[model samples]
Target: MEFKGAMGGIYRLTEWITRLAATNLLWVLCSSPFMFCLILKLLVMNQNLANESLQMNWAMAILAPLTLFPATSAMFTVVRKWVMGDTDTGVFRTFFKGYKENYKQSLIGGIFYTLLFVIMYVDYTVYMTQLSNLQIVGVIMLILIIILLVSMFNFFSMVAHYHMSIGQIMKNAVLLTLIRPFRVFSTMLGSAVVIFIGVKYPVLFLFFIGSVVAWFAFFNFYGTFLKMQDQMEKMKQKDEEQESVEDKKSDNLQK
Candidate 1:
């Protein structure tokens, strides 16, 4: 009986782990098609930045809406459903659902990120024109600010998928990052490692492999965080109910 109990526990643990991994894998697969769009958007943005004379034409204008909005919307659906423990939804369904629910938020978030990018560009351009003593410090501050903003923005966008109010989403995002620094740092480090490996090994489709691995890591980290959030909320509700019960009991005793 003891041996069977131990085996059962082990089996349950293994099953949980497997389910978590499978969820992440499904999200990664669903997100794969957006990779091309992401790359194109990056290329176009870079070109626009490098060549100031390029016309502010329709192509450049539509880049954010076309590539980022759809991709982000799809990601939101996959992540949200995964967080809700919906395993039956397949890759295509997740993508389509995400696109449908997150379209406006994604578009708005894209515009926000783009505006930040533009500000950074302007800051860099202004710095290039000056030879001040604080140039190095200014550049470093700008970079740090940009990184912080981007991280916060990403967290907000993810929270928005749950239809959270903007203020609540931002607050939750900031709190999560502050409280779960290890998870946030690990995500950043894992992404960096994947990119580095991809760049180092060019001949064997390393980029694709690395991207797949990174996506899995990111999905797992994000899903785990969402699960924890749910548990915390449940605990909070339970505590509130207990408090209410105690207050009612005290009132009855007084009466």
Candidate 2:
């Protein structure tokens, strides 16, 4: 028993470490837009290349969706497979396969969400100077931003798991995110802490940040979805039973 327990613990540790390394490495390679522009900025920002730096920043910002869409979709796929105990699909292969498979949908999703966030930011900036009803617009925009980001966690998960249309995905994402508020809060908190750690200790960005945050967030989402599925099944069974009971009662009344 002691040996079996030790082996299990070690296996889990090794599995986690292996996944973290693989996920973060894939994340780095896939985030070329941000990394390349960051490197360019770092090299030129202090060299009096202000105009070029600005252009690089603009390119990075504009490329954000294109860069992140496929990668995030792929990451979510890899995470799902890992969590599902499907050891058959190799991590890198799974990520690339998902990236290719979901490329079009992810690109569209990325564009939509990116535009939504950008619009929110722009509107917030425009309204910051005003002290009128625009404040209400600003507040609404802020709320939308929160909802968008919160739903984003579930959106990627859903995209990985479902073959729904973009509109369907969006609607379900919003609903699922709202269905489990505590899950969203935990994911947000985990993400914030990850960002703080990455900023404070840049070395972690290379190996730990992305995978660690994603794994924890994915855990919460996976549990929420499973619980929801069970609850829905229960409700469905209850409805069926109630319908059967009503049918029987009607039959007796007719008799």
Clashes of each: 0, 0
Q: lDDT for every model? A: 0.56, 0.82
What ranges in model 1 sit over 4 Å off? 1-62, 79-88, 128-131, 136-140, 143-146, 149-161, 165-175, 201-255
The digit string of per-residue lDDT tens for model 1 on 1-255 reads: 999999999997775455444444444444444444445556667777644333333244446554545554464455455555665566556666666666666666556656666666667656656757657855875875546553653453454355765445545655666666666666666666766775688432211443243344446556656789899999999999999999999999999
**Residue-level error in angstroms, candidate 1, position 175:** 4.9
Each prediction's RMSD over C-alphas, in Å, is 7.2, 2.9
TM-scores of the candidates in the order shown: 0.58, 0.86
**Per-residue lDDT tens digits of candidate 2, residues 23-101?**
7889788987777887798888889898998788677667767877678788888888777777556888888998898
